[model samples]
Target: MKTAIVILNWNGQKLLEQFLPSVVNFSQNEADVYVADNASTDSSITYIKEHFPTVKIVENTINGGYAKGYNDALQSIEADIYCLLNSDVEVTKNWLQPVLYVFKNDKKTAIIQPKLLDFKDKTKFEYAGAAGGFVDLYGYPYCRGRVFNNLEIDNNQFNDISEIFWASGACLFIRSKVYHQLGGFDEDYFAHQEEIDLCWRTQNIGYKVKYIGTSTVYHVGGATLQETNPHKTYLNFRNSLLNVVKNVPTRWFLFVVFSRLILDGIAGIKFLFELRPIHTWAIIKAHFSFYKNFFKFLGKRRKLHKKQNYNLHTSIVWQYFALGRNRFEELR
Candidate 1:
């Protein structure tokens, strides 16, 4: 199968400097590389042309955000499998081989994520997506190796290959057909949680999403946007709520929403008491805005369900909420 590797760049020249050579040297067989730049002001374009002439580079007129940037580039390419990789990741040798193995072995698998380690400190997992990802009952997404702002250490202890709720787009390998059918990443997501939305649709189509621990890549956690990155928080919070409305069944949606409301209220009160009123207020406004757009969100949710495989009362919803609260789940 033909594979096209896609990377979206936005003022990431330095990261490209460290990551490009590894990508050029390692992925040499049936795969092709494409870099879509989101109107980077930096020397990212000049650097790519000068150093990696063979790699395809698509330039955007303005910053269209991650999902739109990828959608633009993907429209022109045709491949059996599409690998969405982050610019800040350095892939290990033979990484694609194992991923290809999984894809070829399981015809039912739609997406696969590589085991990601921290680039600065290889001993730990990356913050964005360490292993595979899952969304809790409250629509919070957390990975096995990382939680909100908390990344776990790598003890080489995890070795199981199983199904996951979402595959990290940090370095995802997907079947091109499946990707096009699911309509790529939702542009409304803008940036964060877009992959989760895509994976939900994929699973709904009766396909399995797997996290293969054999293939590995090193990622610089939050390289493009650090912890205090307001863009990250805004998109994460907004898009996660959007996911619940789009994918969760009606009955389960109410349960998830009520549970989240209680947890968020307690947390907000604590923050307000501690003089951290800004954050507390931000949380309140975010949720309020989400509800304010309820009907519009519900319209989209109904649209998504027209093609859904299972309804709100299925095992999928049960498993997602059965676990304790995570990034997508709020634990009391």
Candidate 2:
């Protein structure tokens, strides 16, 4: 099948230097490469044209966020497979082959993600998505080799294909039909947690989201948005809760929300005790704002609940905080 690989860039000239070479080397004969530049103020577009002239470039008139940038770039493209890769990743030679193989062989698979290692320190796995993604009961996403800010080095530890709650947006490979059917990434999401919402819908439709261990890449985590960026934190917090509100069963959703609130409260207290009042205040503000949008979020919850067929008792997210690693046994 023919493939079109799309990369979204936002003032990331330096990243394109490392990423473009790897991408060109890896996907040269197999996939058509396209760069969706978000009107970067830097010389990113000029560099792409000079160095990679054969590569397709779609420069946006405005700096639309990640979702919109990709959506706009992909609107008219026709290909059997569409791979959304981030600008900050360095791919291996065989990275796209395994994902392509899975899509070609597995009729039940709708979305697939590659094994992601950290770029700064190649031995360690990336935090965003190491080798597939899972969520605990409270909607917190963790992967086989990473949790939150904690990343485990690649030790040939994960060597199996597995089902995941979501594919990381950093390097998501999906069938074109499935992607178009789900309306691509939700443009409303702008950036964070959108892929998780997409995968939830894919699973709802009886499709599997697979993590192909053979496909590997190195991701420079937080290249687009720093971990401490208030906006990033806000979107992550709001959209994560939004995903649960719009997907999980009513009782489970309520429990998860309350559980999340308590967790946030504890985090805030910990920050204050450590004399990081700024972080403490931000957490406090996020909680209050999230509640203020409760009714609107609940309305979405009601609508999504009507469409859900599966029931969640204890989400894979909460499993992370459980007493033993055995809690993760069923997940693997």
Candidate 3:
């Protein structure tokens, strides 16, 4: 299969400078490399053109965040598989081989994520991806090696290949055909949890998402938005609720939605107690945005041909907070 590793960048010249070398050295032979610049105002595009003359560059007309950025750049690239890699990720040698093996052999698997370890520590799983992604009954996303703030040590527990509910966008490997057929991503999301929404839609259309744990990559988590940033908080809360609205099955819809409202309120309270008033206010703003877009998202839900039971855990929040189950192995 023809593979393309496309990195989405937006005024991340320093990140590109720091991390792009490893990618080029390790992946150039296995996959075509491209940097999809999201209308960067800095010297990012010029730098790529001058230094890495062989590396392809796709300049988007505007900064469309993650969803539209990829959508716009990908229209012109022809490849059987597309690895939507992040600019802040450092890939290892032979990383593409394992994932490509899965894609070539398994026709059913539409999306895949490699094991993501922390760039700073290297001994712990990264917060963005960890092993692979799974959602709770209430639409909260967690991973096999990470639950909330508790990240597990890299003990190779999740080294085996497995099916996952969603593949992390940080180092996602997906078939090109399935991506476009699902109408790409819901551009309304702009960013945050859009991968979950896309992966859910992929599953709804009878395709599988998997984790190729043998391939490992390190991520500089929070490269664009710090975890504590209020805007990040707003996008996460708002987009997750939007995902639930668009993808959750009808039988569990009303109950989950109502339960999430209460849980989100509790989360906001916790944020305030932690003296992060901005984040608490961000959650409030998220809820209001969700309210305004409820019917619009519901209309999106109505248009879908299928809605599978996407939740893997009964409740991650309950298991982590109320029951004190912090590890993925401890959940059940």
Candidate 4:
């Protein structure tokens, strides 16, 4: 399979300098490497031209964030598989081999994510995507090797390849045909959780999203937008709600939406108690944005022929906080 490892960059010269080498070194033999520049104002473009002349550059006219950046850049590139790698991820040697093997063998698998470990520590799973991603009853996403703030150590327990509800945007491997067929990502979500929406739609169309733990990448999570950034908080909450509205089955839609509002309110209050009022305000803003886009997303939902069953766990919130189950293995 012709695989293109495209790293989406937005003024991340330092990240490119740090992590791009590993990607080029490890992935060049298995795939073509391209840095999809999102109209970066810094020396990112020039640096790549000078240091990594072999690496191609796709310069987008405007900074369209993650969704449209890839959509625009990939249109010019020809490849069977597109690896939408984050600029901050450091890929391991032979990482592309196992991922390529799976895509070639399993025609049903549309998207895949490699095991994401923390670049800072290297021994633990990263927050963006750990083993694989799964969503709870209310469209809350969590991973097998991560639950809320808890990240699991790399003990090889989640080494087996398995189907997942979503693949992390941090380092996603997806089929080109499937990606375009789904109309790329919902650009409405400028960033954050858009991958979950795409992966959920992939499943709805009878394709699978998998996690191949045999291949791994280390991610410097929150490089672009720190975890504490209110804007990140806003995008995550808003996009997650949009994901449910756009993809959740009609039968469970109302209940899920209502429950999420209540849960999010609780979250906001908790944030207030923790002296993180900005996050609380961000959630409030997210709810308003979600409300504003509700009808539009409902229209999107109406256009789909199928909405896959996504309530994998009953409630990750209840399991994690109330029941004191912080680990993935403890949930069941």
Which candidate leads in lDDT?
3
TM-score of 4: 0.99
Which scores greater on TM-score, model 1 or model 4?
4
Task: Write down the lDDT of every candidate, Cα atoms only.
Answer: 0.78, 0.79, 0.94, 0.93
Error of 1 at 322 (Å): 16
Candidate 4, which segments miss by more than 4 Å at Cα? none
Each prediction's TM-score versus the true structure: 0.88, 0.90, 0.99, 0.99
Per-residue lDDT over 1-332 for candidate 1, one digit per residue giving the tens place of the 0 to 100 score? 88998889999999899898998889987589989899999999899999999899888777878788888888888899999999999998988988888888899998999898899999888777788887666677777777665566777655557777888879988898988887888887778888988998888878889988888899886876776554555566667777877887666778866766776677568668988776676677767767887788788777663433333222222343465333322332
Ranking by lDDT: 3, 4, 2, 1
| Candidate 4 residue lDDT tens string, 1-332 | 88898999999999999999998998767789999999999999999999999899999999998999999999998999999999999999889888889888999999999999999999999999999999998999999989999999999998999998999999999999999998998899999999999998899889999999999899999998999999999999999999989988889989999999999999999999999999999999999999999999999999986889887789999999999998898986
Which runs in model 2 stand beyond 4 Å of their true positions? 292-296, 302-332
Q: lDDT tens digits, residues 178-286, model 2?
A: 8888777777568888898888878877788999888889889898888877667677777777776777765576687788888877767877898877777777676
Please list all clashing residue pairs in model 1, or write none if there are none. Answer: 140-327, 140-328, 141-328
Clashing pairs in 2: 135-316, 135-317, 136-316, 136-317, 136-318, 137-317, 137-318
lDDT, candidate 2, equals 0.79
**lDDT score, candidate 3, position 110:** 96
Clashes of each: 3, 7, 0, 0
Question: Which structure is stronger by lDDT: 3 or 4?
Answer: 3
